[model samples]
Target: MTNQATTLPESFRELEPYVADWALPTRQERYDMRLSKTIDELGEFYDAIAPRAEEAIGYLNELDLNDLPDDATRLLHLLYSMVLVSYPVNVFKQPRIPDSGAAFFDTVAEPSV
Candidate 1:
């Protein structure tokens, strides 16, 4: 694999170091970091990136999925995982606001039958 960093959207540049070719963490590594960590504890990472969530999704959506390189494919899967878990569907009626008053919001998923 190339040692060069994968190009990412401006909004995702902060993650460049973490996702660099030689330093990319495995799915298990990412999960291990989150074990027993509260959202409050993890806010530093997400709070900064949450604003760009939509843009990231848009960029991913525009990609030709079938033709992505290994690095790009891995990054795509990582972003999808981030998006899926960050927004709880059935657990809450509305997006929860932090005690610090940051107004992060996401669409509430419809009730499941």
Candidate 2:
């Protein structure tokens, strides 16, 4: 496949620093380390990219959900995941840890096609 980075939307540019590698994993892989970021790091990342989130979502909303290209599909999924996770859902509450222990953890699974 061509470098997916070249095809990403401008709204997604801010996320490049954190998610440059957007690799889709194989069935054998349960999680992708590339998506890992500490809570504070994620907060910073969100702060940087939050401005574009709406535009990204608007672009996604304009797409024909039934017939999106692989890249567009991936972007839509990534954007959707970001919106969902950003909401303060008590059901998905994270555990508290010491500042020293605040480091990126590998847990995000690759988006399923």
In order, the Cα lDDT scores of the candidates are: 0.48, 0.49
Clashing pairs in 1: none
Tens digit of per-residue lDDT, candidate 1, span 26-108: 44444444443455544544554466667766776777766765555555655643553364322322233325275433435
Q: What's the residue-level lDDT of 70 in candidate 2?
A: 62
Best by lDDT: 2
Please give the range of 10 consecutive residues that has the lowest summed lDDT in model 1.
89-98
48-68: candidate 2 lDDT, tens digit per residue: 556777777788778887787
Number of residue pairs clashing in candidate 2, backbone atoms closer than 3 angstroms, sequence gap of 3 or more or interchain: 0
The count of residue-pair clashes in candidate 1 stands at 0
Give me the runs in candidate 2 sitting further than 4 Å from their true place. Answer: 1-5, 20-36, 87-113
Q: Report the lDDT of model 1 for residue 61.
A: 72
Give me the candidate number with maximum TM-score.
Answer: 2
